[model samples]
Target: MNKENLFDTEDILSEGGVRDLFEEVEVGEGEKIVKQGDAGTDLFIVDSGQCVVIDDKGAGRIIDSLDRGDVFGEMAFLGGELRSATVRSNTPCKLLKLSREPFVRFLRKQAVPGTKFLIFLERFMVERLRKADSLRVLISGDQDLSGKRGLQQLRADIRARNTKPLLSADDPILSEICHWIYARNDQVLFREGERTTDLFIIRKGEVVVVDEGAGGFLLGTFGANDAVGEKCFLDGKPRSDTAKVRGNAEILMFTRDTLVELLERDSSMAIGLSLGLGSLLARRLSMANRTLRLLTYEELREKAEVSRLLSEMRKSLRIKTLH
Candidate 1:
């Protein structure tokens, strides 16, 4: 096997001080690097070749034809989640595989800046997931249940649930707040730290919450009925995480100044918002933990079964494909 270059000083392995753990492996055409439903223990960086990603529906989608300097398999490494998709070679390929132990060790030892970089990478991946979700909605013909609900109804629901008053037409803050509408597949929101002047509330459809993992693996997903960008509004801190459209989404946006003014005048409104945010965070953490456990267990079971079946078939079959 040809040892292709895995990392330079600029790569994550280098930054994490685990650059030596990766070694190159050459693969033939049609070679399977990682199969679906496997417990991913290593991440592969493509040095050369085209890799095809196949989903569960037998739909072979080429997410990206990875070339030199592209990384894959990090999702499983970071979260201990099952492989959500399969990767196969389309041509003669060379890749570098980094095992989990050294990878984790590197992360644990890395300095704060390196950790922050990993977090940015995790946030970037989450943003990509949002884009993927939006694309799915655009291609699929599913009716959006939330889209059918009128804005007035959504507003009424928010008002009825809150002890404090919702924004009224006469509220001075309303004039300063701006609304940005993202149709299906629009990147309507962003993670914390993304420089933007808007705070968003889901007016329609759903938004996903993605935790930023500085130089580490992405945390997970957060679904609809979630509010985002409130942290930025409260302390002017960079976005803590990313928010994206789950479907055709409409968002109520407020500028920083307007939000601050509202908070100053209506301390009750601010308190209620904080409480709501705390609830959302609690629910999100719970969901993430549950998903991690479920996905990891499922992946372990599936990998064992697949490995056994593949071994049996390999021993039993002598026939070769004509194609």
Candidate 2:
């Protein structure tokens, strides 16, 4: 049974914000903390002592041990699903509980700690999803294994087409982060002002990025190894451009949440991705600067100034390779 605390105690404890939000409780040995099939909306962190997580669906198997700093009940709170496992104390325990409402309130009030907590929380769910999916594949046997291998190959093909840093075909986690999409000719992937969470990599064929304003202008046509929807995705805003398939196309999608998880796991990969995005942004800025040539001298000077700022911006992103 794979179970580990996804959050660091130091990170959580750094601000009294989250700690202050939690209500403390003391429990005697053999006390049930969370029951299977219960409508659980709160999360628990063990302050001291031990607990056992039992998978009630399968002969009540003991899945993992919980100790001080260990957290449980998060999956239910996050997914708004029934508790799949029952957690009970093995020894007298001290615990801190956080309900969903208060946690949300804290997040709205305390941005820094809230951001850190959410990052840890997202990573936790990603890990759990990975393990659960792996277990499902394993139990399904050779047929599923063969299917997964084909999917892995597809993931690799899309990864090769990504504008970002090269991800190894052997990186099993990348398969989880990237999703494949197929579109027919003239398909509209997304429209301007639509709220979307995905950044797209064109694996085959082409995509035209269109900006709507002044009768809708085409920003550029992107082919294999090019990414789109990044500006809005990274800025946490609605899509500013529409993506239309120029022909039948294959794409790999990276949702913002999963990309954050990937970056958390691999700093080198994060640096590589940042460099790639920086390069792309620089090219766009240069192109935008060139478009100013049609304007008057003052307008062109403004564009030139903006281009200079962009150049400085790219230089500011110092890349450091990890050992």
Give the winner by TM-score: 2
Clashing pairs in 2: none
Provide TM-scores for the models.
0.43, 0.46
Superposing all C-alpha atoms, what RMSD in Å does each candidate have to the true structure? Answer: 17.0, 22.0
Give me the overall lDDT of model 2.
0.58
Write down the TM-score for model 1.
0.43
Question: Which digits, one per residue and each the tens of the lDDT, describe model 2 over residues 1-323?
Answer: 00122223235555546668889999999999999879867888888888988768648877578777777776555545466568999999998788977776665555445545654554444333223322222233322234333434433443344454333434677677677789888888888789875778676788987656424555567887677776654544576568899879888777766555765666445434443553344334323323322222333224544444333322211001100
**Model 1 lDDT on a 0 to 1 scale:** 0.48
lDDT of each residue in 1-323, candidate 1, tens digit only: 01011111134443434556678899999988887778866777777776766654336654435556656665565445466567888899988787767644554444332333333334334333333323222222222333433433533433344332223334454545545565575374776467663656665566656544433223333223445665444334456566666667766676645434544556444334433443333233223323322222333324554334322311210001110
lDDT of each: 0.48, 0.58
Per-residue lDDT value at 156 in model 2:
45
305: Cα error in model 1, Å = 40
Tell me the deviation in Å of residue 306 in model 2. 55
